[model samples]
Target: MKDKQAKWCPELGDFAGPKYRAIVAAMQRDIQSGALPPGTRLPTQRDLAWSLQVNLSTVTEAFREATRLRLITGEVGRGTYVLPGNDAVQLYAIDKGGNHDTIDLSTIVPARAFSSEDLRQSFATLLARDNLSDIMDYPTPDLMQRCRSAIGQFYQPRGFHPRQSDMFPCAGAQAALFAALQWIAKPDLPVLVEELTFPGMKIAARQMGLRLVPVAMDEKGILPADLDRAARASGARTLVISPILQNPTGATMDADRRAAIVALAEKLDLLVIEEDVYGGFTKEPPLSLQLAGRSILVGGLSKLVAPGPRFGFVIPMLEGNEARLPEQNFAIDELVHVTSWMAAPIMLELCCHWIESGEINRHMEWQRQEARTRQSLVRRKLGLPPLGRKPAAPHLWIGAGQDSPFAGLSGDQAAAKARAAGVEIVPASTFCAGRMLSDGIRLCATSPRDRADVTEACKRLRKAWS
Candidate 1:
């Protein structure tokens, strides 16, 4: 089946004007009548041309027709394949069961912000590369270097600078965090995280058999003083913090606070794991703690680029560059053990294409504007409290107070109430870490597909909570 020279001959039939059309018609008949089964290889253009006494172009045209009919798939390096379907194996099937009425305000992803044209164009450019085959193999060190170099350029203008050697590609921000945690977290020694954090961190800490030491915070991220206090008391040597547009609670630490926190981490000899997942949406990112030598930066293209790609990269400070604290250091071995060092090839390639082409910046701008517009709509409709200064950020964190609408209810009950009212929101409980949890809910502004949907959801929220 690998060699096309074995020559598959479907006898050319009469009643067709064009030889190519006749060839296509014969192919369909043979396939339908069980003369040729699914996965049966058709002859190579040249071989088929010789056998049928037809020109190569004719055979090529016929193959294209067959492929267009979904009877085959043409790979670049690999020969055309009879796409196994009908009686053969189906590669995939669409999941048609999903509720359409609920306006989801929990899942934070772009709503109709990306264009199919742009995605297709990026792939087309990727396909044009002569070294496309090289990408199919385990991503080579050189390819990773390309990603690092590209990543460095992307973040450099935003004030994040990591030596290319320090940067490594990962599957997503979650992967990077999980990998680094496996290296540092011990059973008794809990790792420090924002009291209200992205749920992934808690899940990872649990799976890795490490406890979480919650650091108290306010409107601005983890309070520098509180972070130091928790780290010192718990003897936690590492900190996973999201200073830029933090999740569940959209808290951003201002420049002075960020510097203070980084200085405190340095003072306490703590390994600061800076999660910069939401930094790309802003034009002027405050100085990242990742700038410090002891910081492990976890960043990715999920928020800026499409989430399906799941492209992420980790930058572990170099050996000499990190603080000399032995407890704070992470090794490459732990990362390899955590992720098995596998990154998605196709998505990574497409991401590299966008970064190199400078399309990512343009796309990020659109997303920023889109997110802002949605937030404005919700703000106007609900008269909600200021989530933060950045309208470009996705979620709004609201507290459950006694005087507040859902007075006696917990976050889960409030969330259920919101769902019954025709919209869905994430309970604050989902993001809570340890006893220092928030009695709140996170309304992600970018979940609904359109502005009307977002507005409708907000109206429902007001009806439920007001």
Candidate 2:
């Protein structure tokens, strides 16, 4: 009975489209219904083909589809088995220091750069405006254009110059990313991403029912060769990348790497969605992927100023390009409409005021210095080496591979241990896009407001792994 149960096969009842797709659909349905539980071994492709009276190639295609959706995994000695992806949870939604007992370092938030009095003054400034009632009303096209113009002025000095015609303000960077996905990605299709990425992207992609194909990466983010291979293999046209101050690993691609990546994207006809939320931290950040015609640039003040205002913008580099498609323009218009509709006019007004009044710049300068200070404290507490010439990121990565101290432990186990020690840090698995496991964890130095809290948290983390 156990042997028979291991060789599970899906019933191909009346379905639409191709028979291969029907097989995949049946598998999904059965999995959802709990008929095929996680870890259940699936029948061989040949056996399933014979059982369903279908061709071997058809079963192969079905297995390929299932694998791409992260539904099953094939082992060398062992057969293919169902994955527990359907039961996976989103890790990006943080409660934000909800429990005082737990020093939460899991969420990557900028340190508090302003006090309550400063906030009150900002509100006072906004309240003192003569056009208060007009600001409360819905934002008109001209008003929004004014907001974009202010944003453009801000980005111009930061090495990213966007065409006024190509920009759209969003509620936040996450909102901009989702809007970009809606504009470019087709549902149920493959979207290429770095093997380890922002947990929010993973959550958004899963919610949209898109398969994320993980491209291999190095110390400088995603490799161009691996990206090319993954694009060809998966036939994915969209690639989401964080070139500077990448989360978890803190890898920032240099000028040469960025050029190589943009060139590869052009060669593959790939649509690059560049997430540059952390670019403001760099003193001399390299040129952005916005230079490419097939790229969408996303930046936010959440990581720079604060998460409260929820302000960001998206720009599609299609203005005055001869290769621009009519449908692409339509998509951009749809994106602008959707983002504008979803974003709060009041919040946009407040953030725009901050941007124009230079309040955001003060916050950015404070965050830049404070982040480096906290990073040094964490390093000293953890007995880690100095970053030296390498630029410092807001987060630090601790690897637990064979050569490391925490060698036998997985990312989940490390995180669990940290929690038991009354500290919160995110594991590598939370950022992983595919089934590949990583025995590493990420600690956000800037998440906590005080350097002493970061110090104590690092101490607890050391004890947790000791």
Q: What is the TM-score of each candidate against the true structure?
A: 0.74, 0.83
Off by over 4 Å in 2: 1-70, 73-89, 92-98, 284-291, 320-329, 403-405
The superposed Cα distance between candidate 2 and the true structure at residue 246, in angstroms, equals 0.9
The candidate maximizing TM-score is 2
Per-residue C-alpha lDDT of model 2 across residues 1-466, encoded as one tens digit per residue: 0321455666676678899999999999887886875556788889999988999999999998887787875544446766545322544455555767788888788998789999898788878978778766667786688778878877866666677878788889989988887775556667888878887688788778777877777788898888888788777778888888888788888778888887887678777788888888886543443345777788788888888888888888755442542224244667777676667777887888887888778888888888888888887777777677776778888877765445678666888898888888887767767544344788889887688888788888777877
Displacement of residue 401 (Cα, Å) in model 2 is: 1.6
Model 1 agreement with the true structure over 1-466: per-residue lDDT tens digits: 1222225776776636898888878877766775664445566689889998888998999887775555554433345555322311110121212467777777777656667887777788888988889766777777777888888988966876667876778788778787667666665456788977786776676566655667788877888888877777777777888888888777887778877887887788877777888888885553443345676778887777677887887777745644364363355535644442578677677788788888888888888888888887777777664435664687677677765556777676788889788676777646656432357777878877788888788778777866
Assess each prediction's global lDDT (C-alpha) against the native: 0.70, 0.76
